[model samples]
Target: MEVTPLINYINRIVTLTPEEEIILSEYVVYRQYLKDQYILQQGDVCKHANFIVKGCAKTFHADNNGQEHIIMFSVEDWWASDMGSFITQTPADYNVQCIENTELIQFNHETIEELYAKIPKLERCFRQITERALVSSLKRIVRNFSKTAKERYIIFKENYPEIEQRIPQYMLASYLGISKEFLSKIKSQLAKETKS
Candidate 1:
């Protein structure tokens, strides 16, 4: 896979000189996960940070009752990993699973550290990414706290127009913190409003 998006994302974060880009590219490894595979199982250290090239994946946690709640979804051009596991090299409490067969550009934690040492500008790039990720997570927390289920659904659709159709309703319900039946009811209400 051509990792153009990952390169572009890095370039946006820091103007990577040609030599820097080449050095960074040397560390990237391309991998594919089949549908339904767990890219990062709960309790395993997430050693690699993945940049999505194709397909969809989700980060989720399972409750005591064995129910899963999705924390995040990643599609093309997005990155997904267990934050705690990647940083600490500790076992993660969450799982990252491929919803569809996925192609990803992956770089090991060691490789990232090497990049930081060799190209310090790349460290600035990751720092910016971390800040943005934190901000986005906070915004999602606020949205979950303040928005109604229907409203959250609308917002989700607005924000991820491309992935909305590809994602399953049950998974969407988990992400929205609503029951699947509730999501069905909301869809029916939307249909009723449309017919009138």
Candidate 2:
């Protein structure tokens, strides 16, 4: 399997020599899922931290009424996991599903621990990844509380223009915590503004 994305992502956080990359390869597993296939499900333990190689996935939770509330989206070169579940070896509160045919490289808890032991520098790299994920989560929570729906939609579009092209409008609406009709209106207004 192609590993350029994973290599480049790691290189961004920490330098990796050829030997170090070989060590990392030992712990990484590749998987492919079709669109709509689940990488994880609510109440199931999340065993791996998944790095997207070629597609997209979303993390979401279903309420008691069975309505899904999207938590986040991960596209190519991004990572996603219920880190709490992966680290604690407990059931996940959220589900991660492929939004398109996807290729991913994943490292399970045991493999990660082994990697850390074998490659001390990896611990620092992984820590940075965790920290960034936490900061992004906090930012999203703050934005949800403070921003208007239209403002949030605008931010989403700016951050994930390619994602908007790939995902269904209804899914995008769910991610933005708005109804499909409202998202439609917002898109129409933005389109008109751009045309003028």
Candidate 3:
């Protein structure tokens, strides 16, 4: 698969000279996964930082009751990984699963380290990306604690318009920390309001 999307994302943060781009490209590996496939399972070390080139995936963890809670969804041009595990080289508490047949460009830890050594600007690029992701996660946590289910649902739809259509209603409910029935009611209310 062409790595234009990944390269484009990098260029947005820091300009990459042709030689630098070539060096970065040397470390990228392309992979395809079928829908429902587990890219990173709970207890397994997350070996790569995956960028979705096509399709969607989710990061989630199951509770002792075997109930799963979604942490986030990643669509085309977005990333999905257990960052803690990827960085620490330890087992992950969450799972990253493909929601559709997905194509990804992945960079393994060793390759990333090599890129950092060979192209230091690339290190800054990734650092910025990770920092942004961390901030987004913190904001979501705060919103989940403070926002009502309806409000959270609306915000989720607004933030993930592309993802909203591709995932199942129950999965969306899980992401919003609400029940499927409640989500259905929320949608009905929104539909009526839209019609009036």
Q: All candidates' TM-scores?
A: 0.95, 0.96, 0.97
RMSD of each: 1.3, 1.1, 0.9
lDDT of 1 by residue, 36-108 (tens): 9988999899999889998899999988898999999999888889987999999988999999999999989
Output the TM-score of candidate 2. 0.96
lDDT of 2 at 185: 98
Per-candidate clashes come to 0, 0, 0
**How well is each residue in 23-81 modelled by candidate 3, as lDDT tens digits?**
88888899999999998999999999999999899999999999999999999889989
In the predicted model 2, the residue pairs found to clash are none
Q: Per-model C-alpha lDDT, please?
A: 0.90, 0.91, 0.92
lDDT of 2 at 95: 93
Mind giving the per-residue lDDT tens digits that candidate 2 earns over 1-196? Answer: 6677898899998999999888888789999999999999999999899999999999999999999899889999888788889989999999999999999999988778788998899899989988999999899999999999989999998988888888888888999999999999998999999999
True-structure lDDT of candidate 2: 0.91
Q: List the lowest-lDDT window of 10 residues for candidate 1.
A: 1-10
